[model samples]
Target: MAVSLGFASGAIVQEFYVDDDVDRSIRDSVEAETGQALVDVDYGDVVDGAIVWWRAEDAEEEDLADVLVDAMSNLDDGGLIWVLIPKAGRPNSVRVGDVEEAAGIAGLHATTSTALGQNWAGVRLTARPRSRR
Candidate 1:
């Protein structure tokens, strides 16, 4: 998982922002692989990366654009975000199209997506480069 995300150990410690409702196992694995604990969304510190656990109902409850924007705000420059949603056929699963749309609105692009296991789909997000004048 760390390899796929290009995580590397460096002099500065790497930190990840963990959003709400993420699967415990996935979060644990990430923490173990990254060699550090994850900070919750309220951390208010710029992190190297972020993980957003979302559901279909969450989209209805609040704007996905808002959530993505909030997550992005907590990221460092060149940071990344992994938006994990329930896989197709799973309870509370959201459509990939919707996620992509929200990502676009948040000034991000989906770099890739992969199945996290039997139950979850993970999308990697990166910031869009500023447009040249």
Candidate 2:
């Protein structure tokens, strides 16, 4: 199961990785694949390991999950993936709760919290994602 961050209809978000180099690779790959530039990138960490966050365009639910899972699965031991679903409206507050539910659906564990003085929402999801090996 992967932790999910709910969106408010076409809401852009970010993808985080536990490795800097891996982060760069993911950012570059996502931009190249989507032909869209990242909104931003930042340093951070999660239960799995160190991490960096990169802004991403709004994508479909399954497509977004597949993209994130693919990028995160390449790191050492395959680091975890986190998607930041910022608040948009009255329903934006549901992102964290929705992500928790999403993680359960995917058979992954997740934790959610708010930042920026409770102005933004984020979710961290972890799991032993299936490997091609």
Candidate 3:
């Protein structure tokens, strides 16, 4: 998962912010593969990427937008934010449209969606291009 996320051992610490509710197995896999520990929400430094666990039942569009914005605020320019939501048929699963709408509000766009784990699906989000007004 670390390699897939483009992480590698380097002189600089490659930090990835982890939002709440993500499975411990996923975090373990990443940590074991990257030889680095994932940082939590309280991390004060900029991150190379982020993994955000979200549930539709727990939030509204505005809530998700806020979370996404805050999660990416300390991210690097080229950083990727992976939003992990419950899979279809799973409890609290989120619709793709809801994710896209919230991402748009957060000044981001969804580039891809994939199965992140047995119970979770993931959407990769990147910053939207700014208009040079």
Candidate 4:
């Protein structure tokens, strides 16, 4: 079964730093199920109204946190950030605790996590509500 990230049709989604295997699977599933194309973008792309598919294990935790913060500028209000990481016990898998800490630093919270495929896990996140000034 294809996993749902709560995306709607025509929603703009970006794939950032995911490996070839994971990226291909996500692209196929998103296109087939949601009709939303996952745009491949680098760190400097100006993005908005897009679900960001980030591969957390590609970088160190501290670097990933910084990248998340930077990605915030490109995200639209209510946009989802799906962080893809190597499955537990895999060589390059990121620790769950690191993911949580990075989310906190980036002002987002993880809503759910599920297996993306045989080699990857996906963590769905959303921006935290800002306090009224």
Instruction: Specify the highest-TM-score model's number.
Output: 1
RMSD (Å) of each candidate, 1 decimal? 3.6, 12.4, 3.8, 3.1
> Of the candidates shown, which would achieve the greatest lDDT relative to the real structure?
1
| lDDT (Cα, tens digit) per residue for candidate 2, span 1-133 | 1212332222222444323323244344444543444333341222222122322333332444444454344433434545545454532234456566655665556754544222334566666655675
The lDDT values for all models are 0.72, 0.42, 0.71, 0.67
Report the lDDT tens digits of candidate 4 across residue range 1-133.
Answer: 4666677777767666655555466667777666756676663554443343444445644476676776676776777787777788876777667777788888888888888777778777788644568
Model 4: lDDT equals 0.67
User: What is the full ranking by lDDT, best candidate first?
Assistant: 1, 3, 4, 2
- Least accurate stretch of 10 residues (summed lDDT) in model 3? 10-19
Candidate 4, position 56, lDDT: 41
Return the lDDT, model 1, position 17: 30
Which residue segments of model 3 deviate by more than 4 Å? 1-3, 8-21, 60-62, 128-133
> In terms of TM-score, how similar is model 4 to the real structure?
0.79
- Count of residue pairs whose backbone atoms collide, per candidate: 0, 5, 0, 0
Give me the runs in candidate 1 sitting further than 4 Å from their true place: 1-4, 10-21, 129-133
Better of 1 and 4 by TM-score: 1
